[model samples]
Target: MTPPDQPPPLEPAELSAYFALIEVSSLLRHTIEQQLREAGDLSYVQFQLLATLGDAADGSRRMTELADGVVYSRSGLTYQVGLLEQAGLVARAPSAEDDRGVTVTVTEAGRDVLARVFPGHIEVLRELFLEPLSGADVRTLDRVLGVVRDHMRAVPPRSARSRRKGAARRRPAVDDA
Candidate 1:
């Protein structure tokens, strides 16, 4: 008999799928990170930040938006943005909509960096991640991943954590027996 507190074990196929997803993600990320570093001297997170801002219609987004879009902690995003600002790759300005808000814009140099690295980035993705799949397989994978992404994103992102009520209080530490 199973204990009530213990959840049912994963089915074999479920376990295999989860492992494959994780391994593929790790492998793809490692290659992409290397390409970003070598081609643009940018870390993956930094590249994500720049790409997100570059895609914006106005080429600017609020700090919180960037944090949410990049799925990064606000503190970490702030530090990366600071580094980019120091490098003259991006600029921060007060948001016109809200006095307390900050807007970050990708500079021409940032755009230039994106342009330089994007070809190699796409190539790495194609060769390592996409090339093995057929057209139908690619479409099915895209659809499945999109649904998973949407399901996961349904939860409020890390950027919203600080704004939640009672989030200011630290949780009591747990004692391990």
Candidate 2:
């Protein structure tokens, strides 16, 4: 019989899947962090910010938008952005439409860093994440993860918005191209 105060344990298959997911996530993050640090002297968050900015059509995003996208606290995002600014990898400016807002844009230096780091990043991803999966497995993984992500986004914690005021930032920086 189970203890009155304790919840029932996971089933064997559930336990195995849960542990496997945790282990894979941890291992992948650690490996990627090491590679990123060596290649670009970037923290995982910094790499994420840079990569997110790189993918933006304008190569920029509002501060609050970035905070949401990166799943960071507004204050934490501010600090990270400050670090990037100091490194000349990103710039921040007031939004023209909304003076209260701020926009962050990647710099030429940022692009150069991405260019330098991406090849190795891709290789590591291929080796550690993609090579083991068949095409069908990849598709199934993507679909399953997408569903989970969407569900989580609809709930609390992940759905929580920053309490920071005036985070309605503006347009991206001048295109580096």
TM-scores of all candidate predictions against the true structure:
0.90, 0.83
What TM-score would you give candidate 1 relative to the actual structure?
0.90
Which digits, one per residue and each the tens of the lDDT, describe model 1 over residues 1-177? 668999988899999999999999999999999999999999999999999999999999999899778777677888999999999999999999999999999999999999999999999999998899999999999999999889877665655557667775432221000
Note the residue pairs that clash in candidate 1: none
How far residue 25's Cα lies from its native spot in candidate 2, in Å, is: 0.9
Per-residue CA lDDT of model 2 for 134-158, tens digit only, reads 9999999999999987875553332
Candidate 1 versus truth, CA RMSD in Å, comes to 4.6
Native-to-model Cα distance after best TM-score fit, residue 78 in candidate 2, in Å? 1.0
Q: For candidate 1, which ten residues in a row score worst on lDDT?
A: 168-177
Error of 1 at 157 (Å): 2.3
Q: List where candidate 2 sits over 4 angstroms from the true fold.
A: 1-8, 156-177
